[model samples]
Target chain A: MENLKKELKEKIIEALNLEDLTPEDIKDDELLFGEGLELDSIDALELIIILDKDYGIKLDDPKKGKKIFESIETMANYINENRSK
Target chain B: MKSEITHYCQIKNGKVIFDENLLYEDKEVDFQKFIKNAYQFFELDYRKFYKMDPLCKLAVMNSSVLIANLTEKLDPKTALLLTNKSACVDIDLKHQKSITEGFARPADFVYTLPNISLGEISIKNKLRSENSFFIFETFNPEFLITYTQQLIQTKKANAVLAGWVEIAENDYNALLFLVEKKKGIALKKENLLNLI
Candidate 1:
């Protein structure tokens, strides 16, 4: 789980072009939108692609993504349990 | 009312010139790195810049300097007139390649339109004004002068942000100017051409 979280942070930074941030800058429980990382709907779409393409996790329902992508912790936990790859 | 070109920004090669004053220059790096440097040198607070396509990035950066130098707040009705030779072709080609390879990203799909650059500038500046983009064989300062006059005279807009931004592989030329009804260099063909 710890390794998955670290890898997720790196992927997020590269995929989102968060040029000013490093893996250390993001906390496990930090919100991905609004305040912490300030991501938006577009970024949410990009994250969905990452999950589908990289982790083999197809998120069919967009509403469930809100809870699944709440933080690095939630994403890592969800991916750990659901990722087929 | 006679519109005048108040201020202008030019980004050519790897240098940034505003109102005919050199503000930033880095001749050593490529275009992508040059934009990143320009973003930092200008001290822009907008983080969404990183997510933009290259054309939009250049447009936003060029307009931002003029916006920052405004002596007074921008009138909400200020219009935008953007003319470019190579409208978003840089991203269009990349997106085409990504699709041919079977891995097109949504981000790339969203920026396929040239007007998205104007949209990005509007969103960044928080200006809810009329905006238009035109394609031309080259920079057309004459059109800007006439259109600016029409908008100001008709009260459709108080000011106009007119620009010509062209970006291609290993080459880029961007010039953005603010036009007002009065109080700057007279918006004449000679004066506008001199900046280019």
Candidate 2:
């Protein structure tokens, strides 16, 4: 679970080109949207791809991502519970 | 107050890809060959444009190169006002094809928005100021001047790049001018349109 969260943090930083951030700077419980990271709808789409490709978790509707990707904590937990591959 | 043409470049087709040495006179020239020559000089680094709708590609390519050259070191509060026609018409066609083909690419859909070109230019130039794009059947020099002046006078921008950029399947034209307010050169209304 720890390793998956770390990887997820790295992927988020890379896909979004958050140039000033490092993996360690992303707190596990920090909100992934709005005030914490300020990620918007488009970034949500990238996160959806990351979930599908990295964990084999296919989210058919983008809206479903709000709960799964609420934070690094939630993402790690959801992946641990439902990742297919 | 008026601004002088301190720096200028005009590229057409592909030959003058990114040449900063292009100079235009009041006389009309073979715009097509000029564009072709401009293309030959610069190879597009962005592959996404190749896959974009053709009209979208033309608009993106033209604006991208100019913005790339003009803002190598961006001036603060620079405004942009551009005009075009049949914006992303080709993209609409491709979008329809995607629906028929059973899968639509998200990236293609993103470019289909006409305003995306303005965003792309702003991103590339690091310009954060008054910006607008218009779709018109033909060029209107008066509108371009008025809108650009408003941006400057309202403090929304310090300088403006204004022009008409039109592209169809086989036809394209770009007439651009960099405008700003400064001392020494008094900009007269009568000669404004003829400057570019």
Worst 10 residues of 1 chain B by lDDT: B101-110
**Model 1 C-alpha lDDT per residue in residues B1-196, reported as the tens digit of each score:** 5678888899897888988889888984578888988898889978889888889998999999878877888778899999988889988998899789866877777889989999999998888998999999988888988888888888889999987988886588888888887679898888878887
lDDT: worst 10-residue window of model 1 chain A: A12-21
After TM-score superposition, the amount by which residue A52's alpha carbon in candidate 2 deviates from its true location, in angstroms, is: 13
DockQ, per model, reads 0.68, 0.04
lDDT of 2 by residue, B81-180 (tens): 7787777665677667866875454545776866676676666557777778898876676687678767777778877776666666555555556676
Model 1 CAPRI quality: medium
Look at candidate 1 and tell me the lDDT of residue B83.
90
lDDT of 1 at A10: 97
**In model 2 chain B, where is the ten-residue run with the lowest total lDDT?**
B23-32
What docking grade applies to model 2? incorrect
Off by over 4 Å in 1: none
Per-residue error (Å), model 1, residue A41: 0.8
